[model samples]
Target chain A: MRPLRRLVLAIPALWLFAFFLAPFALVAKISVSRPLVAQPPYEPVFSLADGWQGLWDKLSRLTLDAYALVFSDDLYLDAYLSSLRLAAIATLLTLLIGFPLAHAMTRAPRQWRTALVLLAIAPFWTSFLIRIYAWIMILKDEGLLNHALLSLGLIHAPLSIFATEAAVLIGIVYSYLPFMVLPLYTALEKQDPALLEAAADLGATPLRAFWRITCPLAWPGIFAGLLLVFIPAVGEFVIPDLLGGSDTLMIGRSLWNEFFENRDWPAASAVAIVLLAILIVPLVLHERQQVKERAA
Target chain B: MKRGLQPFHLAVLALGFGFLYVPIALLVLYSFNASRLVTVWGGFSTHWYEALLGNEALLASAFVSLRVALVSSVLATILGTMAAFALVRFGRFSGRTLFAGALYAPLVMPEVIIGLSLLLLFVGLGIDRGFWTIVAGHTTLGLCFVTVVVQARLATFDRSLEEAAMDLGATPLATFRAVTLPLIAPAMLAGCLLAFTLSLDDFVIASFTSGPGSTTLPMRIYAQVRLGVTPEVNAISTLLIGFVGFILLGAAAINRLRKPQGSG
Candidate 1:
């Protein structure tokens, strides 16, 4: 069994070594290689002295410029703060909305459980681009919401919604709500009814019982959902770009501009390396939990 | 007696579902609207869908997306399945954690960053940013998902059969080909399909890697959306939703078949 295991494991190791690790190593190497402009498109000009010294200079230079630019530029700083705030808000909203729906599905009259689950996952299965695009139709200046409101005499002017932070918020919340819900539902379904009943019998109010017993028991799932939504939300590109106005200069978009528009490899890699450092802890913890779950 | 759902729970559920479906439902409805302006509903017609079908650029982009998705998804799935087999079957190894982290890095790394870094790598290699560059990008991301799905199936599998086959003098390859492959084939297929969908739907990475002539469907749609959406986008979106809806239904059917009759 052990020897067979060794052989099986070798396959993935070789594959990863060739594709995954090599590509990232290449990214790091290219970040420092002098950008050659005259080759129709930019290419790396690698020289022996240039290789080591260039990496050091590029690394040091990229850190200062990118870091300074990200911090000193009020627009970039504001986009970062707003993005953080929105991702936090969206994750909370998803939990608030998802917990009840997940709870309802698990405890609902038997006939409705599958239907509710299907409904929850249905939107998720659709192309993410379409789902986000769907919001533009509903949230734009003369879009569905404004038209409906105007006809109903709610307001005279169309709401300025299309290119706003609020639209991005709505998009993020919608995109990730299912991610939050699925884990919560899985956790809630496995919960024992007796624990809740016991709390109630001990003279706890229903709310008290839920807060004290259900919440802690469901903490792992809640954390899983948080990691699922929050981490991706931090790095989200499509939602903010599509929904946010010119004011939104998220790190993702910032990185995009650096690579495509500015054609700066070192700067882009610096931003990515920083983002990776920020994301590593949560990702590591989540993977550990997943691995443990499977082992058990 | 236990209480049924409280009014608060009921309201939240209703509001959540309403939020999820209303925007999407409206898009599908408005796609058929005759008005070119998104805000006004001239009348119900399929002119936008007709326009979508008539547009050569849209069709070409869709073709490009399909081709990239098909090639990359197959490659990713094959590599992922092989890796999953190794991970589950192999008891322990030096630097396994490092290897696992590398494999899963693309999953947590923001797509924007991945796209940027990969683009830089390609440019540095003097490689032209085009269809194949996009394929490399998609495959990197797609493999993580494929590995996760296949790993899940492998964990649940009984390993004694493979051991038995090996003990009977059948080589490792023969045992795997005859026994293990048959058992995990469903999961492998599901993972591949999931990879295909993800690659097809990918926008961020594809946008960074692809040059002008190689735009994918999502890339084209994104460009249109950024320029302020028209109903033609709505029409394209409706078609995407329909296509994915069919795929999900098929997935659900397969999932149901995999379970035994007595199990919920």
Candidate 2:
């Protein structure tokens, strides 16, 4: 019975290994390959090709040119910084909005809690691209936002809102806010109310009790939600591509352009490899924490 | 003391909900506008929605997306449910932890990385990147979700019933089909629904895998979105949101019905 059980695990395990891990290993390998003159970017070295000259060519040819290209390029550097800045700000905004909203959902009448969660998650099921596009109609020059502001005499002219950094930030936060809310809500919901009462009884102010007791208790969920939003937001291509102008370059779009436009797979893979390296620490930590939670 | 609702909190709640819906609602409202300019309200008219009906390309993409979702979600549910059953019902093994980690790798791995890597894999293997490749990709991602949900359901399952069935001379497969299948049907259905939703909404992976002219609806919308917004896309957005809203309500109704009759 145990043997049969082990066999069942084997198939799925091997599937992930072959498809998931192997492909990533391939990316890392391709990132190190030599670039050719005219014939595409990559040229594999054959061991049986010939003499000392061939051996020297293969041995000396493992170049960091691709990685060097990514680093030296102004757009790539700017985009990387912008992606981080935008993602950081957006994750913070989501947390600010999500915390209170999630808290409200948890504290709401029990009958309404499920309804609120459904409401929050319903937008997620709708087409994500469409939702981002919807923001364009609202944020553009003659869009709904301008129309509203103008009609209310709040502004003299239509605001230049669309395709700006603000527009991208709003779109990203709007799109991923539900992801932030659900996990935080899960964490906040599990907090024992008695702990808060205990804090208050011990002469802590309500705000102090919340900061020390509630926040610490819910840190796991906060961290989960933060990582969840941050990681995706960093690699976010669509929202930034659509909503951001030349001023707001992002790493995802740079990677996209490298592959689709430049036809430089090695360079694209290099960018991706660096991204993977940067993300590996946070991702590993997140998974470890999740596993610990599951065990508990 | 009468605990009145805080006006500030009420205002915040109202604004938050407004932030969530106003853009989407504006999009829906403009879908009926007569003007080509998405922002301008040239009076109430359903011209774009009417135009959308005649757009063969949009319809074809929708069809492709539907087929992918249906096939992949079904495949994921079956494979995932079986794997979950094996993991829970069967005793622990040497590589159980490793197996569990491998199963979940797809779930949290960044979609951009997954898509690029998979595309690279297809290229390396000399496999054509198209609809079948997309279906394979979707199924792999969907399976992780299904496995997680089904494993949760199986965690609290009563094992004695299965033991008794075995003692009564029922074959393992027969016992599984007759007893276990009936017990975890809700979870199985939930897993399927979840898979369907994920596969339907997936854009990044599909964008990477889908060949030219095989654009999914999201992909089409994305292509349009880069240039500018259009009422046609807005109409599609409205339709999708409406469909999702209906599903959510139905799921809630089913959940309510499943609760005990005398709980009140």
Task: Report the number of the highest-TM-score candidate.
Answer: 2
lDDT of 1 by residue, B14-52 (tens): 887888898888888888889888878799998888888
Docking class of 2: acceptable
Over 4 Å off, model 2: A1-3, A35-41, A45-62, B1-12, B86-92, B95-98, B167-169, B246-264
Q: What is candidate 2's lDDT per residue for A1-296, written digit by digit as tens? A: 56766666666666667667788887886687755544335655445656888877776777788888988988788888888899999999999998887876676667877877877876777777778888877888988889889999999988997879999989889999988988898998898888887877798987898899889988988998898788888888888888888678888888888877887888889989988787777777766765666445
Alpha-carbon shift of residue B81 in model 1 (angstroms) = 1.3
**Alpha-carbon interface RMSD of model 1?**
2.5
DockQ of model 2, rounded to 2 decimals:
0.49
When superposed on Cα atoms, how far off is each prediction in RMSD? 3.5, 3.3
Leading candidate by lDDT? 2
- How far out, in Å, is residue B168 in model 2? 4.6
